[model samples]
Target: MSVAEPRRIVLFRHAKADWPQVTDHERPLAERGRKDAAVAGRRLAGTGVPFDLALCSTATRTRETWKLAVHELPQRPKTVYEERVYEASPGELIAVLNETPDDVRNLILVGHNPGIQGLAEVLSGSAEGDARERMTRRGFPAAAFALVSFEGSWKTLEPGVATLLDYWAPSE
Candidate 1:
């Protein structure tokens, strides 16, 4: 894609996790999470974004979430299980995104919050229609995702550069 072409980032928070005896990183998705994840995937497919890549956290819940969600998409994007995304802060998440290959025009990030939520808020300089309001009001709940778009190279992705195009939560 040309540098001037718009790039889209989907910030997706992992689904709710079960309280297993395993480590936090090993905890799997809850029953509700399983159902919600598929629903999220269907909704994402509905957007017709044609995602090129998925940057997913390495945590078990996040991995599980992606597995279920991707099944609902028309085509699966290349996935990278990134450890840096696990428990990362908003700035840290942005740093990870900055490393994304310029060839990727549409990217989906499956991780945890408040980093996902924080990233959504930090990068969104503005929003379309009621997107910002809905995102703020609904909050970034589990299985929630926000779509943001910007025009620039991945290296230039920074605070306040993107526009919040849409937001979705399983509940809504």
Candidate 2:
């Protein structure tokens, strides 16, 4: 797709994690998280966005979430396990995204909040319909995702540059 064509970024927060004896980075997902991750995956597939790449945090929970979620996609995109996404702030996440090659028109980032939620709020200048309201009301819970659309190269991404097109969370 050309730079003129719109690009999409899916900001996905990892599902609930279990408080294990391991370090925070090594904690695994809870049973509920496993199920929710799969459901979120199916929901994402329903959106019909053919993702070109996935940038996943190297944390165990995020990795597991992506593993289950990607299974439901029609076709799995190329995935990169990046340590930088572990506890990155919104600005840091933007830096990582800015490095994305232009060929990736649709991309997903599987990570933890408040970075994920912060990124959504930072990037979305406006929203379509009740997307922003719903996102705020629902509170970027486990297994939730916000889909933002913008134009231009990934390097051009910045605050107020994208529109929050949709938000989804598993029904409690």
Candidate 3:
């Protein structure tokens, strides 16, 4: 928490939603998905983490999840559309994250599953702790998210270094 330190980035996958028949990217949140996202938002808001900014994919489900989750926060965070996130791999996400500006210290990225979970596991150094174990076993359910702390600047990121601060989902 020093002035010289860079801010942390937290990654979240959109909660359970109605998988749309139209297309994968066009899906919207189901009733339960909406409720779960709200609950998760409230829980995240209580953490006292301050996200200076947020980035989300253009997918309807991802967009909706970000809105609902941010609602519980004390202040609104500056947000942007990351077109690349719709089907981004962990490597792609890390690339986008590293390209972010230096002024931003804390950020939230809300996206989809598998990819997000993949990123979390790849970034975390070891798999001994409860968080790693749970991730390894469950593979991140819908609405699942992980708070990771990274060393060095956001522009200089590599895999297997970010520390997992917490992981949560509606089920647990």
**Can you tell me which runs of candidate 3 are displaced by over 4 Å?**
1-6, 126-129
Regions more than 4 Å wrong, model 1: none
Name the best candidate (by lDDT). Answer: 2
Clashes of each: 0, 0, 2
Compared with the true structure, model 1 gives a TM-score of 0.98
What RMSD does model 3 have? 2.0
Model 2 lDDT tens row, 104-169: 999999999999999999999999999999999999999999999999999999999999999999
Ranking by TM-score: 2, 1, 3
Indicate the residue-level lDDT of 37 in model 3. 89
Quote each prediction's TM-score: 0.98, 0.99, 0.91
Q: Is candidate 2 or candidate 3 better by lDDT?
A: 2
In candidate 1, what are the lDDT values of residues 1-172, reduced to their tens digit?
7989999999999998999799999999999999999999999999999999999999999999999999999999999999999999999999999998999999999999999999999999999999999999999999999999999999999999999999999873
State model 1's lDDT: 0.96
Best by TM-score: 2
lDDT, candidate 2, at 57: 99
Model 3's TM-score against the true structure: 0.91
